[model samples]
Target: MSKVRKVTDKILEAVSIFILGIMTVLVVYQVVTRYVFNSPSSWSEAVVTYGFIWLAMFCGAYVFGKRDHMAMTFILDKFKGKAKVAVEMINEFLILLFAVGVLLVGGYFGALKQMTQADSILPISMGVIYIAIPAAGICMLIYFICNEWDLVQRLKGMKEKEKEEE
Candidate 1:
């Protein structure tokens, strides 16, 4: 599980970096073309917009996998032992449900609906941009499964330690 998580982390990191780099270059090009050449590059602008969407979605999933997403942990900080593990598990389950119901299912339908629509500047279907939603959802699901497994292992270890202490 850890190996799988590590590979996924590297892959997502690489993709996010690549997208950022491309977007940066495109933005620079857009600025140069507009200011230096006195003409704006419409295609670059469209590409950068789509790239930013992909970057944001992928990076969000990556952050979730790293367990680095923002949260108000004041309530969580009060839990102890098995209760803490249980609460964490429940929280993860809720997030997993949201990823499935909203990001996966809803995103799929949204992308499908956009498939028939073409972007004004880009030569591709609008679905191409929306597809990132479901892709990130899939990444989130994988990370959730890995997280749940880790929590179960931790809970079992805690139980074993308690028995030893007794």
Candidate 2:
């Protein structure tokens, strides 16, 4: 079980890192060619732009996994017992729903639109750019699920403790 979880985490981390690395390399290569070689290919700009879309989405998912997704702790710290649990669950569920909606509806339509369009500079299909939305949404959903499960267990434990005190 531990091994499986580790593998999953590594996969998510690697993919996020790889997307960011590609973006950096592409931009750097483009700059070098335009300035040093004195002739930059038009395709380089398109590749860099598309790579950035993937990088930003993946980075958002990475933030969720790390539990560093800009949360407000003061409000949560003030609540105790079932109230806290409910608030936490609701927050997680809302996030999960949003990710699922984007992954399913927005992603589907976006991919369709992309496939139909002709990219101005690159001969590559636009589907490549739109696919990142769904891919990152899935990753964000996975992180939400994992984090929600852990929170639910803690909430249950807190309830049990409060009952014992009463």
Top-TM-score candidate index: 1
lDDT of 2 by residue, 105-166 (tens): 68867988889787888886788778888887877777777777778788889878888999
Which portions of model 1 miss their true places by more than 4 Å?
none
Minimal lDDT window, size 10, model 2:
1-10
lDDT of each: 0.95, 0.78
Give one clash count per candidate, in the order shown: 0, 0
lDDT of candidate 1 over 1-166, digit per residue (tens):
9988998899999999999999999999999999999999999999998999999999999999999999888989999999999999999999999999999999999999999999999899999899999999999999999999999999999999999999
Model 2 misplaced stretches (Cα beyond 4 Å): 1-5, 163-166
Candidate maximizing lDDT: 1
